[model samples]
Target chain A: MHIRVENLTHIYNQGTPLERTALHEVNLEIEAGERIGLVGPTGSGKSTLVQHLAGLLQPTTGRVLLAGTPIHSKGATARSLRLQVGLAFQYPEDQIFEQSVFREVAFGPRNLGLDETEVKARVHWALEMVGLDPARIGPRMPFTLSGGERRRVALASILAMRPRVLILDEPTAGQDPQGRRALWEKVGQWQQETGMTLIIVSHALEELARLVERVIALRAGRVVADGPTREVLSDARLLRDIGLDVPEPVALLQALRQAGKDVRTDRLLPAEAAAEIASAWGLRRAGA
Target chain B: MKAIPIGMYVPGDSILHRLDPRVKMGVTLVLMTIPFAIHSPWSYLTLSAFIATLVLLAGVPPRTLWRTLRTVFGIAFLMFFLYLFTTPGEPLLAVGPIALTWQGVLAAGGQIYRLCLLVITASLLTFTTSPMQLTHGLEAMLSPLERVRLPVRELAMVLTIALRFVPTLQEEIDKLAKAQRARGADFTGGPLRRARNLVPIFVPIFVSAFRRADELATAMDARGFRSTPHRTRMRRLHLGYRDLLAMLIVLGLVLTLIGLG
Candidate 1:
C-alpha cells in the first residue's frame, strides 16, 4: 500500500504533566514497493512514526493515510490496515508466546481468518523465507531457540501475514555479523519475491546503506535529512553534528580522503569503498 | 491508555507527607477501624468528614480518589437495591410488587457511605505515602513480630518489590497488548474468544516477568542485598511533634465517634 503521513505529531501522555511530544509535525510519503531506511539517534521518534503507519498509535495532531484511506478510523478498515502494514518491533522476541515456532508464526495468518491449510502454508513459506528449515524448526519450542533464531521466528511471524508494507524497527539490533547478514539476505530475497514496500529503522549504517536506496534521518522528533542513501550517509559532518555515527565504510573513505588521498568519500558499503580506494590509489601512483 | 493516570501517589509538600510513616501507618490503621466501630449516622458523618479533610490536607486531588470509587458504583447501587427489596423492615413506598422499606434504604445508604469512606481513606494512605516509605513503615511497625520468628523484614521487602514492579509490569503488558493487536489479535469479541486471544499476549508477559525477576535477583545479589536483623536504613523513621499532633487529632475524633455511636 502507498503510505502518506501528513503533518503528523504525536504527544505521549497528553494532558498529563509527563506529556512529551515524541514527534513534531513530521511529513513523509512512501510509494508502493519503495525500500526506505529510517535512521536516527535514540528518542528521535522513529519508532513512534513507524507505529503510526501501522495504525498501532493514533496521531495526536495529523493523520496517516494508507491507500488514500485514513487508518485512525477504527473498525474493519483499521483491521485491514493492520494486515496490510506489518510492524516487526524491536526486541520482537520479548512478546513471543506460542509453544511451537510453527504455531507462533501461524498466529497472524490464522487471525486473518484464513483456513488451516492456508495458515500452515503461509507459516511454512514465511519460515523458509527467513532461511529457517521449516521441517526441522517448526515443531521446536520457540522459547528454547537461541536469541538469533528467536528473532528470525519473530520476523517470520510478521512475514506470515504477507503485509504489503513491512516496517522493521531495528530488525538486526543485537545480532552478530553473520546473523545480521543472513537475516538481511533473507529480507532482501523476500522483498524481491513479494515486491513489498519496506521501511527499516536501524542504527547500523552499513546495513541500511547496503539494503535501502533512500535514507531518512530524524533528530529530536524532527526530520533532519531525507535523500538518497549515498547523499545522506556520506555527510559525515552533518551526521556527526547531530551526534549520529555515519556508516563505517563512509567514514573510512572520508577519513582516507581527508588524509590527502584523492579518494571518493561517497561510497557507503565496504565493497564500494574497497573498489574506490584501490582505483584512487592506483591512479595516484601512476600520476606520481 | 495514555490519558488514564494509573498511579495514586501525588507528590506534595503537606503535613501528612512530612509525618513519619510509622506514625502515619498507625493513624491510618486506627482510622480504618472507625467505620466498623461507629454505628450512628452522625458518627459516620463525622468519620467521613474527617477522612475527607485528611485527603484534602494531603493535597490529593479529589478526582483521583473518585476515579477509583467510580468503578464500585455499580456494585454499590446493586447492594442498595438488594437491601431495598430483601431486608425485613417497615415499608415506606411501593413500586408495583416490590415494597421499598425506609429502614432498608437507610441501611443501604449507611453501608454504601461506610464503604466509600473506607476506600477513600485507603486511597489517601497510598496517595500520601511513597512505596518506599510504606515499606519502611511496615517494617518498623511489624519489627516486634520478628521476635516471634516471623519473616517480617522479608515480607516487607517482598511488598516493596511487588509494589515497584506494578508499574513495570503494567508497561510491559501495554506494549505486549499493542504488539498483539498489531498482529490482528482482536480483543473486541465474545468473552471466550477474547480470553483465547489474550493467551498470546499473557504468555509473553509471564515469560518476560519471570526473566525480569531473575534479572532483579541477580542485580540484588550484585548489590549484596540480604535479609538480616542488623540491616540499616538510609532514612530513619522518627516521630515528631507533627506526628503526635496528628495522632492526637485522630485519637480525639475516634473517641468522639465511639461515644456518639
Candidate 2:
C-alpha cells in the first residue's frame, strides 16, 4: 500500500501544560513495494510517524492518505486500514503476549474473524516465514523461547496479518550477529515473496544499508535527508550531523578518501567498496 | 482509564503547597471526622466554609479542583438514590414501588453532603503534594512505629516504588494495547470482551513489571540500599510555625464541632 503523509504534525498532550510537538510537518510518500529505512535518534518522531502509517495514531494537523483515502476514527476506510499495515514495534515483549506461539501468531487472523482452519493455516505459514518450524514451535510458549526466537515469534504474529505495508522497528534489537543476519534474511525473503511495502526503522545505518534501497533520515522530527540508501549513507558528514553512527563501509571509504585516494563512497556493501577502491587504484596506476 | 482525577497533582505555590505533607494528611484525617459530628445545619455550613477557605489557600486552579470533584459528585448522586430507597424510616411519600420517608430524605442528603466533604479533604491533600512528597510524608508519619520492629523503611520504599511505577505501568499498557490493536485486536466490544482482550495486555505487563522489579532491586542493592539503615535525607521535612498554627486551628474546629454536637 502507498502512504502519503502530507504536512503531518503530531502534538502530544495538546491544550495542556505538558504539551509537546512530536512530529513537525513531516511530509513523505512511500510507494507500494518500496523498501525504505527510517533512521533517527530516540524521540525524533520516527515511531510517531510509523504509528501514523499503521493507523495507531491520528494526525494532530494535516492528514495521512493511505491508498488515496483519508482515515477517520470510524468508517469503512479506518476499519479496514488496520489490516493493511503491520507494525512490529521495537520491543519484542511489547507485541508477544500470547501464551502459545500458535495462538500468538494467529491473533491477527482470528481478529479478522477467520474460521479455525484458515487461522491455523496462516499461523503455520507465518511461523515458517520467520524461519520457525510450525510443527515444533507452534505448541510451545513464546515466553519460554530464546530472545531471538521470541523476537521472530513477535514478528510472525504481525506477519500473519499479511499487511501490504510491513514496518519492522528495530526488529534485530539485542540480537547477536548471526541472529540479526538470519532475521533480516528471513524478512528479506518474506518481503520478496509477498511484495509488501517494507519500512524498517533503525538508528543503525549498517544493517539498514543491506536491507533498504531508500533511506529517509529524520533529525529532530524533520526529514533531514531522503534518497537512495547508498547515496544517503555514503555522506559521512550527513550521518554525523544527524547524530547517527556512520556504517563501517561508509566510514572506511571516507578514511580512504581522506588518506589522499580517489575512492567512491557511494558503495554500501563492504565488498563493493573494496572492489571500487581496487578498480580506482587500477585506474590510477594505469594512468601513471 | 486515561487518568483518575484524584491521582492528578495540581502544581501550585500557595500555603498548602508550602505546608508539610504530613500536616496536610493529618488535616485530612481531622476533616474526615467532621462528617460524623454533624448535629445541625450550622456545623455543615461551617465545615463547608472551612474547606472552601483551605482550597482557596491552596491556590490550585478551581477548574482543576472541579475536575477532581466531579467524580465525587457522581458517586454521591448514586448514593443519594440508594439511600432514599433502601433506608426504612418515617414515610413521607411513595415513588413507584419504594416509599420516600422523611428520615430517608434527611439521611440521603446528609450522607451525600458528608461523602462530598470527605472526598474534598482527601483530594486536597493529594492535589498539593507530589507522589514523592506524599511518600516521604507517609514514611515520616510511620517512622515512630519502628519501635515495634516494623520494617517502616522497606514499607515506605515499596510505597514509593509502587507510586513511581504507576505511570510506567500505564505507559507500558498503552504501548501493549497499541501493538495489539495494530494487529486487529478489538477492544470496543462488551465489558467482558474488553476485559478478555485486556488479558493479553496484562499478562505481558505483569511479566515485564516483575523483570523491572528484579532489575531495580539489583540497582538499589548495588547502590548500598539497606532496609534498616541510617539514611540521610536530601529534603528534610520541618514543621514551621504555619504548620503549628494550622494544626491548632484544625484541632480547635474539631473540638468546637464536637462540643456543638
Q: Per-candidate DockQ versus the true complex?
A: 0.69, 0.59
TM-score of each prediction = 0.93, 0.91
Give Cα distance to truth, residue A285, candidate 2, Å: 13
lDDT of 1: 0.86
lDDT of 2: 0.85
* Model 1 lDDT per residue over A158-233, tens place: 9999999999999988999999899888888888999999999988888887789899989989999999999998
Residue B248 error, candidate 2, Å: 3.6
Q: Model 2 over residues A101-215: C-alpha lDDT tens digits?
A: 9998998999988899999999999988989999999999887888888888888888888889999899888889999889888888988999999999987677788889999
Clash count, predicted structure 2: 0
Clashing pairs in 1: none
Q: Could you list the CA RMSD of all candidates, in the order they appear? A: 2.7, 3.1
Q: Can you tell me which runs of candidate 2 are displaced by over 4 Å?
A: A255-260, A283-288, B1-5, B39-42, B85-107, B222-224, B251-261
Best by DockQ: 1
Model 1 interface CAPRI class? medium
